[model samples]
Target: MPVYHQPRKRIILLIITALALLLIARLSYLQLVEKKYSRLADANAVFKKIIYPGRGLILDRHNRSILGNDILYDLMVTPSAVRNVDTAYLCRILQIDKTEFNSRIADAVRKNGKVRPSVFAGLLPAAVHSRLQEGMYLLQPGFELVPRPVRSYPYRAAANILGYIGEISPGMLKMERYADYQSGDYIGLAGLEKTYERVLMGQRGIQYIVKDNLNRPQGSLENGAYDTAAIAGKNLQLSLDIELQVLGEQLMHNKTGSIVAIDPATGGVLAMVSGPSFDPNLLTGTERTKNISQLLADSSRPFLNRGIQATYQPGSAMKPLTALAALDEGVITPAFGYPCRGGYFSCGRRIGCLHSDAGHADNLRLAMSHSCNAYFLHLYRLMVDSDKWGGVKKGHARWREYMASFGLGHRLGVDIPGEHPGIVADTAALNREYHGAWNSCSELYVGMGQGKVAVTPMQMANAMCIIANRGYYYTPHFVDHIDHADDTLLRRFREKHVVAHVSDTAYHSVVYGMEDVVAHGTGKGARIDGIAVCGKTGTAQNRGRVNGVVTDLKDHSVFVAFAPRDNPRIAIAVIVENAGTGALFAVPIANLMMEKYLRDSIPLAKRPMVERMMK
Candidate 1:
């Protein structure tokens, strides 16, 4: 061979040697490192089964499980494996028509594709499950029974607060957060379930099943060697008192409104009831989809959680806050008096007073006790038009700021979803609304808990907490502590939220006045046998468009209160929609709830009152 041919031969040798090494490395990686294709290639010979963990339990203050789980069967389907099966017999066992059966199979195929299994008929009834199980072997390869755990409400209370779970949607599949989740996976849809999903969802496990030629599960693949264990979700403990919750629900039966009770010290919600509530069980098992559809179609909107979602005028329930704002601004003292004869005419529009007597508002304490509309209207005017903050615009702006600090005008960041800020018109908004020419008198209705102001039952209840605690409040919450969860998930709830540095004297006057109201004034209905209940009544007017004109619907009966006066424990707000007056319905319900929570049992004498309210 020539010298040039020798050089070419060496180059060819090096190239061949490098090619051999590359092929060896690729084969080693495929055989030992890459596990993607090591599984049985035939879709019928092996199946990947997802083992879902048991979802978290929700307990009450007493550690009693309020929301747990129940086992139900889902008829899972692998669309491609469907062969010669008795479709009509299977549909009969499942209690579905041929069209419905075909529709479900088509849907499963569309959702998860032909190779994967999806829920054909989920959350089967016991009778259906038994019948289907007996015939399951005949329906081999296509459909199989898979156990699924669903939520159960033992007491059947707190439907809106506990929320519901549903299957993951297609849109969610495209998102990175839901990457691990498959089609038809159950997820929390609302309320506390939605709020703590990450902590409560736990971990899902995978198991490979060995299958015969007929696609029947023979046993665990590889003796379960490749199986992963499912970890159960962490439990959650709420501050709720189930007994109190039961009582509130009973009292609110047939009513469309809300009742929110909180621990004054911790801001932990004891009971939050949104009336026209259905049993939480309705959203689980066989009846879920149909019941949800019915609920959604209901005219009253049973899912509208009024505690934080609905907003209304504060009515006379706002007098105490107005008084506090004025006192804090130094525009009024406890001794400041307002002489009223049925109404306040200073605004030249006549903001009417409930009590017509001239002596009804002789002093701040008397005014608060009587809920004299004229007195509070005057105080609101004094704050916004005081010339202390340069102009009424700035003063009004400052007043709104004070209210926001009091947990008004914005979302309180409650654990639940869909909380409305409740319409605290800003200065710019006011300017746009009133065309840059307005004063405290322009919205005197707000001072009397009417007009441009709107508030949620949760905010009102939290405001009661502020007064009960003398100027500070915790952000109202349901879950007190999550079992096995880190403190990082709950630090915000543990921190204190101080509103203003109002003097103790101001708090004393307001508390004493509210006490007097319960003792011998408009809130007399809220009086308990031994507890010093400080309360205020409200008849909040509701308006809506009728045909074309705006007209008044029935006024909402509202009441806000705290128990024992000194060292208060429970701060509560109740609103009964379309009810005539606050004293007629809201007062009795609030006081009854307080009594039940404090005493744990009602006296025989109060039994009649409970019966009447429960009606």
Candidate 2:
């Protein structure tokens, strides 16, 4: 019995020795080879902290405030880490009932895993933050109060232009491109916010801190040497003039159209006011949901940016472009005259003009000044009738190219989003629309900026800029620059684009005719003394008929003008829907805008028309 016991004991001793050696080797490997990993794990247990850099400010052209930062707190919670705390206490501190507290906790857990903190409430006001900061120690172990900057629009306007920020949806979070963004991060949703997100959203930073088992922060591991500091977003300098913008907004109070004014030399947008605009502040804070609902429910669509979004028949505002095209194409000369046979003209068809029965004849200058329909109709026939016009085809294809050169029929590449490219009918499109045949009658309305041609007020303003520039124009821009550390944020759209079909001479001729328009022609109402204001008036007919006949519908009054014929400064486009005639409704408005821009103020009595319209 003693001999057998000795053998078994030796075997058991050897096995125990082998086990000890293996354990020692594993410990040595962990301590030496994986030293960094073990050290990080140890550090994470003692300290955990995060850094948030505030968003940058957005200023006006003069460095005046448009959008600024407001300090707010975001309450976050880790569902699994919350223990022994009364839900009632938490609810009381949060100013919510038990139901809301439970719902919020459940939502947090559902939206994100319990391993990390999820946002429970966001954009809490300073007053609310003050109340919560006192009771923060009573919160859950893994809870956090992150100080963040929320966007604040100080001007309370440019809602469509300044845009708003919203939380990134789960779908966006799922995409690898947005992996850096957490579940509660805010992102730009529209307008300039959406357009220049990269420049506006600064890089996020991280910090390593040690925490105890109770999840309370202990201290920094290496005195913040391992931390990355967030680079603040660049400050944007917009070209908008606060005073001018406010004035324009006031003038458009009761109207339903748009007015866009641009510095012709630099293509900087001075004022872009669309009727039915909303307050930008409404889209920023706690009132967002209610305000959005109100805006959506309103019949007037106050949120729509009519300056860049709404497209309408440009009416006679398009005449200058058309005239330039005709002159450039060599289809018509300045001296070429077309007779207005009373109030109608039949080119083997029954197409009639508004002044046909009045019986007048006009050259290019007189025709444009008077806005004579017969003259343009005659020009349209010659343009489309390539067979009769000596093989010089000035049909839809040529006309479309010329119009495209003026930045029509396409997006103008403006800094703002949601710009309409507008509708332009080519031969194929017209044939498709007419279901097989396109006639000269189809071309008649287009020459007068009716039918298939439509444009946004912004585009119309851009066209006027091109005309004012005498052959070329810089693309309109709202932002002039962005201030950044590495000079990486300064962005300017300074590219010049030439109006293709028209030459400098052609532009000059058109400009001369427009000048005459204000001096002695239909646009005389827009005349500003000592300013050399050149303008064109449009009275576009609507689609609806009054009686059995298509009565001349209440027209959309339009005016496009610039000052100081030799060297233009400000170019503007104004449109008033169902406002009779351009001379009556739009010209006076243009004059007021001109006087305001040039003289820095308008005479009260001279603004009678504007006051009447306001009433």
How far out, in Å, is residue 441 in model 2?
2.6
Candidate 2: where is the Cα deviation over 4 Å? 1-48, 84-86, 93-95, 140-144, 348-361, 387-394, 485-492, 544-554, 607-610, 613-615
**Best of the candidates, TM-score:** 1
Index of the highest-lDDT prediction: 1
TM-score of each: 0.93, 0.88
Q: Report the lDDT tens digits of candidate 1 across residue range 1-615.
A: 777799889999999999999999999998999866665354557788988899999999999999998999888999888999899889777767988988988898788778788998888899999998888778876888989989999999999899999988899888999898888789999998998898888899889888887677889988999899999999999999988998899999989999999998998999999988999999998888899999999999999999999998989998898899999999999999988999888877776777897778898999988889889988888998887788888888877887888888899988899999998777898888889888777776777788878999999999999999999998888999999878887789888988878889998999999999999988998888878999999999989899999998999999999998988999999999999789999998998899888888878888889899888
Q: What local lDDT score does residue 44 receive in model 1, on the 0 to 100 scale?
A: 55
TM-score (C-alpha) between model 1 and the true structure: 0.93
Name the 10 consecutive residues with the lowest summed lDDT in model 1: 35-44
Q: What C-alpha lDDT do the candidate models reach, one value each?
A: 0.89, 0.77
Candidate 1: Cα lDDT at 102: 85
